[model samples]
Target: MTAVKVIKVVGTSEESWEAAAKEAVERASQSVEGVHGVEIDHWTAEIEDDEIVEYRATTEIAFPVQD
Candidate 1:
């Protein structure tokens, strides 16, 4: 049997929520191995004068642990 682990990470972007989510996974992959999937748990944004200035994403990264 294989063991898996999950970690929560948050990422921010000036562009869009999609970009923020992608960044969260990518950044986690840089420090973590066996990254298999990412689940977007939540989304938030900063508003500036009726415009969205920033986007943030809460993600859960799933990876396998080595034996």
Candidate 2:
């Protein structure tokens, strides 16, 4: 039997949402192990002076529970 857990993480990038998501996963992986998958949950952006300043991505990361 195996158990999995889900965690929500938010990452930001001036480049793209994909980069933001990847950043979140990479940052999480630094301290976490056994990562199974990452699911993009939602996306939002910050606007400054009617222009997009930054992109933010919210992701759900699934990983195996460590014993």
Candidate 3:
């Protein structure tokens, strides 16, 4: 039998939302093995001086459970 797990992780970057999302998956993989996929839930940005300073992404990461 096989099982999977899903977890929510937030990533931030000075670049774009895409980069933030990718960072979430990559960071998760560093700690949890068998990282399979990521689903972006939403995007947000930080503004400073009326300028976008940072991009944030809320993502769901999926991985297979290890025995």
* Candidate 3 positional error at 37, Å: 1.1
What is the alpha-carbon RMSD of candidate 2 to the true structure?
Answer: 0.7
- Superior candidate under lDDT, 1 versus 3: 1
5-59, model 1: which lDDT tens digit per residue? 9999999999999999999999999999999999999999999999999999999
lDDT per residue (tens digit) for residues 1-67 in model 3: 7799999999999989999998999899889999988889999999999998999999999999989
Considering lDDT, where higher is better, how would the candidates rank from best to worst?
1, 3, 2
Query: Which residue pairs show collisions in model 2?
Result: none
lDDT value for model 3:
0.93
Alpha carbon lDDT of each predicted model: 0.96, 0.91, 0.93
Off by over 4 Å in 2: none
Worst 10 residues of 2 by lDDT: 27-36
TM-score result, candidate 1: 0.93
Candidate 1 vs. truth: CA RMSD?
0.8
Each candidate structure's TM-score, on Cα atoms with residue i matched to residue i, is 0.93, 0.94, 0.93
